[model samples]
Target: MESFASLFAGLGLFFIGIRYIGSHLKRMTGRRFRRAVAAATRRSGTSAIVGVVAGALTQSSNAVTFIAVGLVTAGLTEVRRAAPLVAWSNVGTAGLVLLAAMDIRLLVLFLLGLVGFAYYFDVERSARWRHVVGALLGIGLLFLGLQYIKAAAGPLRELEWMSAFLTFAGTADWLGLVIGLLGALILQSSATLTIMAVTLTGLGLLSLEQTLVLVLGSGVGSGLSVAVMAGGLSGSARQLAYFQVAVKLLGSLGVLLLFWLERDGGVPLLLAAVQALAEGTALQMALLFLVIQLAGALLSHPLQRPLLRLCASLAPPAPAEALARPRFLYDQALEDSAIALELVEREQQALLTRLPALIPADGQVAPPPAERQAVLEASQEVVAEVERFLSEVVQRSEGDEALERAMNFKSRNALLQALCETLDELMTALDTSNGSAGPPPLSVNLTEAAHALLDSLMEAGGEGEAVDPQLLRALTADRSALMERLRRDLLRNGADLDADQRNGLLAATALFERLVWLIHRYAVLLPDSLAEGISQKAPERAST
Candidate 1:
């Protein structure tokens, strides 16, 4: 009973360590880590390498798998690239077992000491340094947990019940597989089960063959975990999860087949060769596991395209997904300032395109109030999301390009606000008129001017052309004339106009003048080079 408690306690600590390490590593890397993976996944070999490195460092292939899934779902990476990523992550997870096979108490102690000093110096206050300290503490806890498990399990061999159980476990080929799978399912971590197998092997409670079987089952368990984790996901995410499961199942089957063949005199041949090169039974088994994993990856590589096609057929992206979500502001790109800024600019452009629709067409019936309100609400949500995304991008911005991009985002935000305000003011003025006759000729002309300026700006921006500052100046040059004309008409018509009509006209004209100035301000604020680029692209697009 005492030994059982100790073993459970050690397992608890081990789980804690894994969680700590995975979470802290995520914090340290932020969304940039996902971005890096997306970029590296352009090539299968590089993607696999990234998978291995990420898996080894985090000791959680699930972490790597989900990251891949996220990038794929966001359309940041292709399914073919993610296929090797998942395959290699499974291979990378074996590193933990190898690390546990060594004596690393001294290393653990050093790490713990470093963590202590970090805490004492308050270095952990910084998010980046906090991740480092958390990782160190986690490693220390992992080693300490291993020691506890070793101590607790070592004495189990002395009991008669344990001795009998071990004897039966050795002869029962399927027992290890069943137990491994069940334990791993309960723990949600194959690495946890593999480490236990390693500990049990070191204590003489399990043989190398049994350890191998258990580890293979653990691989299957990890695959199932991925599937379960991805259950709620759709589109590319679900496909990526299934791909991971397939890869792990293939690896497990390959290893099991090799074990079956080894029993038929093939073992003696390979064991003889491995024994000559490897020193320990556990080490030999770990090497075997890694080799089988690599073989499985190679075997699975050819199926990448088929798997992708299968996933696409199985789960096509929903049509409403684009409308329901922010298409360009993906979290994966948020850490890359260039990509993120571009995405923000794209979304801002989209928002601007909707502005013209809010303007009432001459003689057209007004849209229902409910419909207008809904549109405004949706626009506000998009505005909030874009602002948050830009804030994240700016936090990571450093270079001149990033700085310029941030400034551009700010200017675009200002323009969007002005556009929304202008729309609201126009709506209010129309309401004040009690939905009476159409807007006066001056108001109509002002609306036309605003629409033209908006359309021209959007077109020039889209074409990568700088709006000639002179052209913008010309557009706003008539603003003073329009304002004076509106005021004169308001006074001359004051006796004929109701108090509400007078107020509405004044507010509407004032808002229109503000809109013109806002546009001019944004255009002027744009850097010379970008303005030049836009101007240069404009004529080409027009000619084409």
Candidate 2:
């Protein structure tokens, strides 16, 4: 129990370190990863290598899989070409496991203390350096944890139960394979399970053969994580995960076949057959593992389409109404006035998240109503949620300061509702084709310029924190000026274009002007109470 505790603590720290290191590495290499994912769609051999290399460096198959999934979902890549990424990720994960299994000191603790002291000791900008140093230190702590686990497990030889288990595990191939599979499933980390197999083999309780079964099972086990991740996302994702499992099951059978062949004395078995083969020696073993992974990858591509077709065969795809889902609105974490302010900012981000579906015909910006769905839904939810949150906060707090912020919260919510109402009205007008006067035509560039100004204002309005009333007014004026300029240009060029072209241009002009009004309203929604200083120190901010 004591040993297990020590081992657990060490491993806990080690993983946290791995997480920190992974994050920094991810941020540093994100652009490269993006390009690699894009290049892989071309099916160029070099791009496939780049894909695998990035996955290994990050030590996250989930991350790579997600990227591939996004690209596929976005129609950027054919589902057929996406299979190699899965194969590449699984193989890359094997490399990460090998690396994480190495020993390292708990240097992250030392660095944390050093950074903490340096920051307090008036070292200029030391705190700013803390994040990078902390991440590096986290990597060190991760290894230290692994070391402690090793030390703790050293006592297993002295424990009767441990010895019995080990002996039983070593002697029984089927049992060992089951344990390995179950353990990997529980851990949700194939790498972690593989290291355990390697460690157990080193302790001499299990032969290399027993460990081999477990490692193979571990590959199958780690897949449970992907299954869990895909559970929330149905359709293609669910089918993809299911098919991947079938591939793994088949691959496991192949491993069993190879082992059975060796036992038949058709070929002399190497003593090292049990050990996980690497690039070092037993190139055949490495090749075998690669083959299984590649097979799984190849099988995954055609399988999804077939699976989808099979599903269709069994029961037709769900009707559009059955599968219809409401877009997820903004997070509702902003109940406290301080938190509500922050929540508004996040909701604004959510609004911008999917507004691209509405890009204008000119491709400069989205249609006004279309843009509002993403932004309006996000803003509406946030404002409503914050109002609810502030109500609770106001009831609980004692201080006048808290009370004042609550009032400001109400004002912000009102502005949010106003924006929604305005947008709803605009969309209705467009649909109704109200004989409202359309703006005059202009140069295509000028029309595009007007659309751009509107989008910027919409984006800025959604970005609630740093919003300045002066900036809002400037955007409003800029949009109005662009509309006037575009009107003049349309009159100048209207005669040059064919009649059909002229009609199309006029329709586009009307849509762009309406969108401009929508954006301008977003800027106008910013009340004095919504800005940072005003809400935070209500009395002081008001005075300023």
TM-score of each: 0.66, 0.52
Error of 1 at 308 (Å): 2.1
For candidate 2, what is the TM-score? 0.52
- What are the per-model C-alpha RMSD values against the true structure? 8.9, 18.9
**Per-residue lDDT of candidate 2, residues 248-306 (tens digit):** 65566666677767865666543234234443322333344455555565555455567
TM-score of 1: 0.66
How well is each residue in 91-153 modelled by candidate 1, as lDDT tens digits? 787787788777788888888898889999999898667888898788778777888889898
Model 1 RMSD vs true structure: 8.9
Model 2 RMSD in angstroms: 18.9
